[model samples]
Target: MIIKKIIIRADASIQVGTGHVMRCLALAQAWQDKGGEVIFILANKSTALENRLLSEGIKVVYLLAETGSYEDANQTVDFAQKFNAQWIVVDGYHFRAKYQKAIKDFGIRLLVFDDYGHAEHYYADLVLNQNIVVNNKDLYRNRETYTQLLLGTQYALLRREFWQWQNWQREINPITRKLLVTFGGSDPDNVTLKVIQALDWLNKDDLETIVVIGGTNPHHEVLQKEVSNSSLAISLQRNVSNMPELMAWADLAIAAGGSTNWELAFMGLPSLVITVADNQKAIATELDTQGIVIHIGWYQQITLEKIGMVVQEFIYDQSKREEMSQKGKKLVNGYGARHVTSKMANMLS
Candidate 1:
């Protein structure tokens, strides 16, 4: 089945961070690869998504204000109606059932993308999440409302580049040298600063640290200022596109608790997790229980002492490190994006 007109509604900003728009971009790329026509209905209030979408040459119908309300659906529905959009996809966490139902009468098939299982999603025709603990009946409430449930990491929204890297199992002590730190696209809480400061105590000259910051990050200037005169050979990367390649090269990841958590798991990259956002706490807890990551709690709660101890534990315990990596890799493979795209395609037809 050919997808002709697909309109995606998602947002990103200093407040919402980069995950929402990034995932939507990944999905849009996948759809475009299959010869589908895609446009975006984006919020105008945030320059983040608008800038990125424009850079990608994707057509965007901007909603003038940033009110994340059910009323926004009316504007999108009107826009979709004019364009004759066949499918409308939404990914924002703030988007509720009422907002989705508002567009249902527009004759566009509704697909809701989410990872947080906090609320009931009764309006969607299809729901997607790559997390392990999602309970469809509980989350959707209207389980019999004909909504297709796409669950598990097999549906993770990862870009194609993560699969292109060529790597072989080389013999390097798993506990040595390389360190990767990524705190989502926009580290709004300055978790990057806290994490990097914690790493200061571990100031090993031999350790190679790579920090990936988002383009819309408000702390980007502050972080650059802090790292400018640093003696450490730290590679500070902004708006990175080659994440999977970077992940493949690293032995460990020190990251915020979010979608990247699953991305790391896909590469078998064990991590030390810090929950920067409230929505991330559940997955952090689950991964922590599985021994894939050592949870250092929320960003504000985590201390230099806690980070130092976890870093030391991962460094000294070789077998434990390997165990975590193996378990994490087993948790997620690279098929997630394909699975979700195929499902959405089938549904569209």
Candidate 2:
């Protein structure tokens, strides 16, 4: 059977961050590639994010109601009925059991993208947890018996652009000099500034820095000012299109522990990870344990001296950097999106 129409329910903003919407975009891209139509339902929208979806030829339906509210769910159901969507994909921690059950009660097939199983109960036809360290059975013990679990990094939803770099090789330099810093889309706590400040303290004349920020970041002006005034050679990249190229070019990175961790792993870029949110703790810890990245403690606990020290260590240690590069590549093969799309297509058929 052909999966003709798909409705994706996700949101992007300063508070919620853009990971949910971006990952859903990856799935939507795969669906569209297979001749399927996709529509997005969002409550809190950013103009730049909406423009991105429009550029990809996908339709967007704005939801004025609060996220995960009864009214929001009703609006989602209304749109699902209007489009006759074959499947409804719900992402974000805001979406809970009630929201999932409401869509399922409307007689539509539901696929939920989850992190840490924040839902009190699960009613979707499929529940997907794309984290590397989650125990599916333990996290979703209360889920409906009919619900199928798609767990772990095997189903990691990456964007279409990264797919093209699957066979691309990275030239790991013996002495790491170039660095990339990205602290997710929102960075509400302004961790990026702290990182830049740390780099400034390092004061390495030979270091080259590339800083990437999202459109919704409230600290953009502050960051630009910081970069301009700092002695370090920092290049500020906002809402960049060539992330894969930047990842390829960087010898090392300082990043927040989020979905971008998977992208960095796929590219074999060794990184120093800082946990900016509670949900990120497990990911950072696991990556650190696996020797894929140096998981520095939480953002609040991490000081500039600590960041500078770690940077210096990574820069001078060629063997450890090479080890991290190899381990990260082994963890993520960069084909998770295609694998997930194939699974969804098979399920629809």
Candidate 3:
């Protein structure tokens, strides 16, 4: 059965970050490939991102209301109705229980992309928590009987670009020399600068670094200047399209504990994770405990010395890096988006 159209309610900015929008794009791409139309209702605006979505032939509807507010939900429902959307997918931490109820009140089928079960309650037709550490069913125990739970890494939503690299093999070097640093789509906290500053402590001529900054990043100028003046061999990449290639080329990664962690893991790249936000804590901790990554605590608490020490340790310990790489690859097989889309198709049918 053709699923018709799906309405996605998600936003992106320096403040809210871009994970929600990107992941939604992944699901939208899967649905689009299956002969379904996708429409996005966004509360905030990012011209570059909007253009990117438009480039993919997806419709973008700008909503002039507070994110997750009653008005926002109303606007979303209006758009969904206009498009004759078969399902509404909502992502972003700001979209809470009230927002879910508001959409459900319209008698619309809803899919909630959640993290850590932040809502006071769950009322959506489906709830997807794609984090590895989300094992406790009690988190969603308050949900409605009809609310289906799609938990764990199996449902991790990765974009179509990543799918091309699934069969790609990663070569682990005996010593770590190349590093990829990505602090999510919007490093509002400018943790990328701190990570770059910390690289100064390494003082290794052979060390090569690649730093990726999102288009919405407020500190791009500062970061570019820092990279220019730095003694380290560093390349600053903005809004990169070839992430999988970069991940494959790097021996290790210094990344924010966000959605990119899953991508890194899928690429079998051992990484040092820094929690830039509270939402990222669980991901960092779980990956650390599972030996898939080295957690460096919160971004605010981490110093240049701490970052240097971890990098040095990883560089010297080839065996440890190899182990982490294998563990990470074993954790995420990179077929999550396809799996999720298939389930969504079945649900719609």
Candidate 4:
């Protein structure tokens, strides 16, 4: 039997962050489980992120074409044809409507992962937006008739490491102390420093935190210096392969409003979210309204005082944190990646 192959086109860096590629990695892992091959075509120059993919036995190809240009689509389609890939997955704002059409016109099945409706018109066979949108119908009303949308938290794709924690129960502390802080794979704004300073402001003797520094994060040395001088019991970890263990260990989290929130939710960890990107604003707002997370507003507008105050408030609110944890687990079941891969397999069959 011929091995089915999937071509994934996504990029990650300090500017774009790693949400697109990371979520696509979840899908890639799911496909790999089914004995399929995965190839990543990236326009990013992140050696760290590329190494992570390479470690997973996935092929990585750098794209020299101008980002969001017609050549980018051409190169992606060219790779898909060369491999005789069964599916082409495109995830990024740069892979807009015209780009989707170009891939579909080549008669290759296309899967577009989106957070917001960045595409003016979606021409992919499947458009997967794993974020909670207020209205799915309005988001893609101009999509192709054959395009099928997989929207909301139910379809949130989580990495393979999070799968085993689906049934793990968290023992919430009466007063929260342990904290996990991560701003996706690239904290472009260095929002983490604000959080660290805020933690120092708290001045609690028992407070401990594990700050995960992403591989693509350029502000590492600056952050390292800041953490080294801090009085709080904060540890800096980079390129963490055991995120689920950290999630399981933490009593609460202060994270960016990215795909990592879904993993935290799946692990039933209550969190305070800060929107580091424009696309995350709506999702964070919705999650806050649902009590899935405590949305602390945009990173730019958020002050160090505000972060301190929110953490303080959450530390005392045992009932609220417990509720958030339960609601979070219910929102994401950890099988979304497998579910999506099953759908893709069916489509291929």
Candidate 5:
């Protein structure tokens, strides 16, 4: 038995989003599959992951956090000591070097999951940011050369289901009626509404809109109410389980340039993506430049008119749409989860 206990500290909700929690969960599941004890040190505040963790039967310790303080780190240190965790994985962007340094003396290996490379990371033994085209040379300049850098979607920690569903039928002839609009688990910026309003130009009778919202989404009630009054046949989903099927069935997707961007790419679903945050800009630009997906700037910059125009262009042009779809399928085969997990396991042994 490895007998190594891994502890993950991450948050889930509108501000934090489900992407962080979901990916960490996938990694934790992989760790457990390898016969390692996995513990999640999560925030006490209400999050979508709270119920999910309880259901999974993973040992969890809640950290009562305070704004603008390192109190959470102290709490986590005590919890890790009690659990005898050998590895501590930090997945939140809010954590600074000071927070990481505080737990360094505990003799636990540090793993930092980052996308935004804005802040300096001095304490991480392993750093994983699976962005498609990251400025690795620039971002990792100050970090120690010993830091194991895991970059690109090949190291993307997605669930095993995506890998199983990789061999999807190529959408040779798209109907352009079924559409999926999902902006992370919790759309803090209300990007879903913007996309929904933009799709009004399409024929309502012909289009079927599937809007996936998270349980912790503050705007969930608002989105559902708006969808109820919409002319199109809209399916308002709350934390759906059949995401792979939904993405596979959709003719096109309108989503935030986050983790789901890769998921859509894996499913060969052509997309019109908008940047929900600054960290997502690089991958969004890379995907757009590669001719895989249509890039509309951030929510503030992209208007209803621009979104509608882009959708119309993609919908009417069969050759262009098909070309993009083919490129997307070819880009990622959805073996990312297995690849990432195998790498993590290899690192351990």
Candidate 6:
């Protein structure tokens, strides 16, 4: 086992979304599989997210201080010491150099989950950037000599539910009909409703769509009403646990370009990615440049009518769909959490 105890510091909310927490959950699950214990130190109260963690047999602790603030790190350290945690992992943009150094000041080993090299400097024993396109790795060149970077999709931490489907083969049909639309755990801008409206414009009598909403989506009532009234065949799924199964069921996905992108890739589901966050634009563009998915530009900059036109064109592009599916499956092999956990064990040794 890898020191037996680990603590993760992350938060989920409308502003921050749930990617950090979900990815950390993947790490926590991997640790659990190795007979290790996991605890979460969060700055916000997301009841559904918290309940999901508890049901997985992991413990969660909410911090009273502001997220990523100096005091936030202080509270996290107190819990790390209380549990005698072997290592502390921090994820999210709010966790910066000060937060990392504070955790390390206690002599506890630290691992940091990074995206786009947001931190100016790092003191963590290990730093992981799981995105396929990370243009800012040079930013970490000035860090401590002991700091190690684990980059690329090879370290993509997928949830435990996806582990079983790692080896499952996808058989692409000649014609695409089924669709999956998910805009991450929190669609604060209600982009999902727009996507649904676009799907309605497709007006393909044979088309089917599943629109997934996160637990924190404040516009659920509005979205549900739209779904109930839509002429297109559509269903709304909330806080679903069978994401991998859903991915397998769909021929293609119209999704928000976030952590879920990796899941779609692992399942060999070709996607049209619409980015909601500012930083997500670069990642989406890179995925497009790499031929992994078709980037539909920033959410606000894209119109629903334009989105419908893109979907209509993509539906009949059989050759392109197959190419993207194969390329995606090759990029993410679904052993990321396994590789990361093994590295942690090696670090302790």
Which lDDT values do the candidates have, in the order given? Answer: 0.76, 0.88, 0.89, 0.89, 0.77, 0.90
Model 1: ten consecutive residues of lowest lDDT? 163-172
Summing lDDT over every window of 10 consecutive residues in candidate 6, give the lowest-scoring window: 133-142
Question: How do the residues 1-349 of candidate 3 rate in per-residue lDDT, one tens digit apiece?
Answer: 6558989999898988898999899899888888888999888888989988998889998998887899999989999998898799999887899999999999999999988888999999989888998888988998999999999998887788898887887888888889999988888889999989889877877999999988888999999999999998999999988888899999999998878988999999999999988988978998999999999999999899999889988998988988898998888888777887778878877
Candidate 2 lDDT for residue 47: 90
Clashing pairs in 1: 154-336
RMSD values for the candidates in order, in angstroms, are 2.3, 1.2, 1.1, 1.1, 2.2, 1.2
Clashing pairs in 2: none
TM-score of each: 0.91, 0.97, 0.97, 0.98, 0.92, 0.98
- Best prediction by lDDT: 6
Query: What lDDT is obtained when candidate 1 is compared to the true structure?
Result: 0.76
lDDT of 1 by residue, 14-121 (tens): 888878777878787777777777788777455655676777667877786555586788877777777787788888877776777777766678888877654455
Runs of candidate 2 with Cα error greater than 4 angstroms are 1-3
lDDT of 5 at 311: 79
**TM-score computed on alpha carbons, candidate 2:** 0.97
Model 3: per-residue Cα lDDT at residue 93: 85
lDDT at 204, model 1? 70
lDDT of 2 by residue, 7-86 (tens): 99998889878988998998898888888899999887589899999999999989978889888888898998899888
Q: In what order do the candidates fall by lDDT, top score first?
A: 6, 4, 3, 2, 5, 1
Q: Which ten residues in a row have the lowest lDDT in candidate 3?
A: 340-349
